[model samples]
Target: MAETGTAPSVLYEERSQRLLDQVALKETDRTPFVFATRFWAAKYAGITFEEQMYDAEKSAAALEKVLVLLEPDGYVPSLYIFGPTLSALDYRLMQWPGHGTDRNATFQYLDREYMPAKDYDEYLFDPTGYCFRKYLPRVAGAFEGLAGMPDFPSLSEWRFVGAMRAFGRPELRESLRRLLEIGERAEEAAQKSVAFVKRMAALGFPSAGGGFCKAPYDHVSDFLRGSKGCMLDLFRNKDKLLEAIDKVGELLLRGVVEETRAGGTPYVFIPLHWGLDGFMSPQHFQTFYWPGLRKVMLRLIEHDLIPVVLWEGDCTSRLELIGDIPRGKAVYWFEKTDLVRAKSVLGDTVCLRGNVPTSMLIAASPDEVDEYCKMLITKVGKGGGFILDGAASIPDEARTENVLAMAKSVRKYAS
Candidate 1:
């Protein structure tokens, strides 16, 4: 790999520290640039999206090309899912390239309600039971047999013998057999992901996020109930839904804390999907979204982990409400929200990242891209806490010259 400053190890340290300093609201020598992307690497490197998912080494090769050319301070890895791993579980949550969409197309999620509103009480009372018996079967075909199994929590002494009979069912036995295959594929995928990160480190590019998580409301609205079901529950099942959110929020926090600790990286990525202005009223956001999200962030901070939140849609109306946090402990990355206004509202409280229009990146001239980046650097990066990135992330169709211009402008103006 070509050296960034002098040597690979030395450059890695410098880049990692630059990101951490920006997170802490400290002025850096220059504003850090993080290339957050998914399929852009594959498209840029002349590989199909299917190749990026099914071939680990090829995906890394594609990502290496981008890192060598752009040399951003850090990057969100371009390859995350392994197709074979999902195939093992017969996962139904998303339809990936070559599976549901065209080989060159990006993965698409199916947003049907996996958990109906009537099951809220059961989930609140025994989430483990609900996941195994109710939730798993709905989302993954591999777990259809699990639906027949009795709740283990109620088993004891003589009751245990009856539970064993449930496992003896042919379908349940087949599910257990399939689980072994899933476990093997999952372990292989985990190792490849670890190796991929290590390879990026050796190339002198630190990953922008160490771990991943989501707000409790998003977890529910996204996976459990569909957006429509969850929204209607606000009026029909308020008490039960609130109870379930707290239970799931605590579980998510514990799991993420453990994962981040094991990964030994300071930044935890939390993508907020349901908290945008178009999703709910301000009162509903205050009641259902921010409190649970704030709890998760505070818990992460207590453990010395920084929560990097991506507000995916326009959240311009909710900026002030979102700023009630300890300064220098988090980052709020915006997708469509006005960055200049965000900087004014949250400049002193948290690190700011992104708002580059993806449309501009895909269609505008390189000079137009450079001008936009210059404006962002001069206005938002005027203060200490800022990092340059795409609005959501680098679009799959973004022009190479436009991205190069973004990277170039950062050094030209911020440095």
Candidate 2:
């Protein structure tokens, strides 16, 4: 890889050294820090979600704002930009079939499907103008409710919001063309994507996305198809469901892994499920949701990539089933997960992060943030395997001071 020269590289190396310490299971200059955010940053910039999404300057400025405020030991930008920036020309083609709540694909989730019509599977491979009618309104309007709401995620997006804000209609169109075309056109797109990303690595962020894995159920519901279809396939033609994931899993993971490798990311994100807790029981998660992801995670770490699984929805109740994850090859980002049990089952093998209440950032005092963060560090930050993040992305409802204080205190006290 050609080195991105000067200060950015210098800062990257500096941060890398600290993260490297954590990865090695040794004490770093300080505890390693990591947080995924956009809402928090947008609030600081005084810009709407629209401004942040289409304007790069606003995105970066907002990022700088977060850096200035929280100054955490680690960071990961939100995924709001990639689809909009790299695929803008085909934004109409690339479907984001997310409901307000669905972020993971299926194995185990709630008793709902964002796209109940997924059983048709007609939309999976077809690219028709008709599908655009239903998809576009939701895609553009996902944040429409937030148009008047303060600190919308779209407004603060650097590539999506920032770029659109700065560029003329023609320039925006050309950039999108450069970004959307696959292979050579895709090559150009990836390069432009890399430029912004390299800037981040150069600006001192530790890179890792090769390990990006979320529950496929969310993917099922949002992108290719939805849970309603997948679940039906699972029950009616179990073999077909298995075979389909076997093929799709490789393709989805290969791109995420390759992108992370391309960007030189070390730690990648994985959210696991088949739906334990309120959604489904532990047995179901292991059989349907996790087996496929388990294969994916195994392959990821086999290549020396570290997997950070965001175990959403009360995964604390189901660790015994999932505990077999390759130890020391990954860390757990526990959301609504039980940390004590996680530490018992996962502490020795994998690193652990999170479990702080999302509501804490919105309503808790700084002392409360500090106390909760301090508690997590005390419980999980031992032996150098933990990094601090939230059970979920710190939301717009979270108080800025509380969020900043959470990061500050976690870094200050985490082992």
Best model per lDDT: 1
lDDT (CA) for every model shown?
Answer: 0.87, 0.59
Alpha carbon deviation, residue 348, candidate 1 (Å): 0.2
Q: Residue 407 error for model 2, in Å?
A: 2.1
lDDT of 1 by residue, 170-238 (tens): 999899999998888778777877788888898787887687888999999989998889999889999
Provide TM-scores for the models: 0.97, 0.72
* Residue ranges of candidate 2 with Cα displaced over 4 Å: 1-14, 82-203, 208-211, 215-218
lDDT of 1: 0.87
As a TM-score, model 1 comes out at: 0.97
Inter-residue clash pairs, candidate 1 = none
